[model samples]
Target: MIAYDNDNIAKVEQAYMLKTECLFKLKKKEEATKNNLLLAKYYLDFAEGIFQNDIQGALRCVNYYQKGIKLYRDNGEPQKAEIAHKRLVEIQKEIPQIMVPFSIELDIKGVVDNIKINMEGLTFEEGLIRLTQMFVFEKQEDIKNRVIGEFKDHPLAHMFGKRCT
Candidate 1:
C-alpha cells in the first residue's frame, strides 16, 4: 500500500483504498493472514491518529494495539505479540497523564503547603493551565542552615542578601 501524506485528504483516501485492497487480498486465508490484516489496519489507524494530533483518536489506537497484540499471540508470533503489548502499555502510561485527573502534593519543611485548589476531574493539561492562572509567585527564598542564603552557602539561590521577613 502507498504511504501517502496524511495532510492531503485525497492521498489519505487513496491510501485507505489501497489498504482495503490489501485486506481483500488477504480474505479466505489462514488465521495468521486475518491477524496480519488486523495488525496492518491498526497500525495504519494509529499512525493516522498521531499525524492528525487527535488525542481521542490516539487513545482509540490503544484498543487496536491490544487487539493486534492478542491476534499476534494467537497466531504464534510471540515476539511480535510481546512487542505489540509493550507498545500498548507505553501508550497507556501516557494516556492517564492526558485524560485522567491527578493531584500533586508538595511538602516543604515538613509542612504541607496548602494549594487550596480543586483540581478534581481535570486532565493534566487543564490542571497546569488552572494552576498557572490561579497561582503567582511574587518572590521566593532559600533558607539554608537557618540563615539568609548566599552564593557561597547556597549555589541554588538566585536572590542575594534577601532574608525572610
Candidate 2:
C-alpha cells in the first residue's frame, strides 16, 4: 500500500513538472499557443486524476486547467485545440469537430430533420458530403471550386462544372 501511494505521488509530481514545462514552451510557440496550453491542461488533469481523493486540491487543479484551456480557445487557437481534440477523440470516440454546414437551413430541413442517417463514425468522405450538402443550394463559385479541388475524383464534381476535358 505504501509503495502504491508513493507511485501515485511520484506520478502527480512528474505530471505537474511536465505541465509547467509545457506552459514555458508555450511562450515560444506563439502561433501554436493554444495547442501548448491544451497540452499543459491535459498534464494537469492527469495529475489531478492521480489524486482523486484530495477533493479540494483536485477541484483547484480542475479550475486552473479549465482556465488554461478556455484562455487558448478564446484567443482563437483552433489548430491547437484541434490537436488536443483529436487525441481526445481517439481516447473517447465522441469529439465534436466544427463542421460548418454549407447550407444550414436547407440541409437541416431536407436531410437531417427527416432522415436518420447514422453517421456517428462516418469517415472523412461521408463527413465532407454532409458538409457539402449544407452548401449545395448556395451559388458560390469559389466554394464550388474548392470542393471540386478537394474531391477531384468525386462523382459530384462533374455536376458542378465541365469534366476534365
Candidate 3:
C-alpha cells in the first residue's frame, strides 16, 4: 500500500498479482476480485502519468484501461466498466492519437480557461494562425516559433525555423 501511494508501480503490481493469485487459489473470490479492481485502478493512474511522454506509454495505457473494464465487469461492477469505457471514449475524441498516429491536439478550451488565451471555440489550427499573427505583429519571432512548434505535427510546423514575415 505504501509502495502504491508512493508510485512504486512495479513493486505494487508484483505484490498485488501474487496476493490475488494466492487468494483465488484459496477460494477467496471476493478478496481476489477486490485486489484486481485496485490493481486495475492503479494501472489507470500510472498509464495516464506516462502517456504524454512515451509512445509505448499510450499503448499500455489503453491496454490497461481495457483490462480494467474487464476486471470491473468480472467483479459485477458494470457501472465501473461503463465509466472506464466513457473515459476512454472521451480521450479518443479529444486526442485521436490514441487510435491513430501522427496527429495530436492541444486542448484550446483548456488554454482559454487556464492560460486565459481567449481563443475559445476555435480550432487548434485557427488558434495557431492567430498566434502567428499576434506574435508577428508583436515582433516576438522566437516565441512564435517555439509556441507554434510545440507539437511535432503542429499546424505551423513548416513555418518553424523561418523568420516570420
Candidate 4:
C-alpha cells in the first residue's frame, strides 16, 4: 500500500510513472504488468486533478489517460479502460479544425500594349469583390477598363469571366 500525501502529489505521481515505465521495460518480472497498470491509473488520476480548467493541461491529461487505458487493457481491466478510451475520443473530436491559407502569384503582360502587371496580396474575398464590381456595376467602367487592358491575355481573366457568368 502506498501512503497518500496530498502535499507531495506531483512528486508521487512522477514516481509512479517512472516505476510503471521501469516495470514495463523488465522482460522476466512476475506480475510487473499488473503493477505497471495500477501505477498508470494512479498517475492519470493525479494528472487529471492538476489539469482542471486548463486547455494545455487538459491535453497533457489526455496523454496520461491514454497511457492508463493502454495499461488497463493489457492487464485485462477492459471495463475501466473503455471509459478512458471513450473520453479520449470525445476530446479528440472536440478539437477545432484549423484552416491554412494558400497563395499563388501570376504575372501578365498587357494586351495591344506591353505594360507589366502584377496582381498580388489579394485574398479570395477581395478577388471576388473586384470581379463583382467589374461585371455587376456598370458605373465602374474605369476599373473594368484598367483590368481588361492589363490582363486581357492572362489565364485568370477567363476564370474571372466564368465566375461572373
| TM-score leader | 3
* Candidate 2: tens digits of C-alpha lDDT, residues 85-163: 5544343322112212232122344456433354556787986786666454755998788777878867644433342
Tens-digit lDDT track for model 1 on 18-127?
A: 65556658773464365465544555455435632445755666765766666666656778888767777777767655653334444453222333345667889987
**Model 4 Cα lDDT, one tens digit per residue, 110-159:** 42122112224567787666555544555588888877876876854443
Better of 3 and 4 by TM-score: 3
Q: What's the lDDT of the predicted structure labeled candidate 1?
A: 0.57
Highest lDDT model number = 3
Question: What's the count of clashing pairs in each model shown?
Answer: 0, 4, 0, 0
For model 1, the stretches where C-alpha displacement exceeds 4 angstroms are: 1-55, 100-165
Runs in model 4 with CA error above 4 Å?
Answer: 1-14, 17-30, 93-165
lDDT of 1 at 26: 74
Superposition-based RMSD of candidate 1 using all C-alpha atoms, in angstroms = 19.2
TM-score to true structure, per model: 0.37, 0.24, 0.50, 0.43
The total number of steric clashes, by the backbone 3 Å criterion, in model 4 comes to 0
Candidate 3, superposed: residue stretches over 4 Å from native: 1-8, 97-165
Lowest summed-lDDT stretch of 10 residues in model 1?
107-116
Task: Assess the local accuracy of residue 14 in candidate 2 as a C-alpha lDDT between 0 and 100.
Answer: 53
RMSD of 4: 15.3
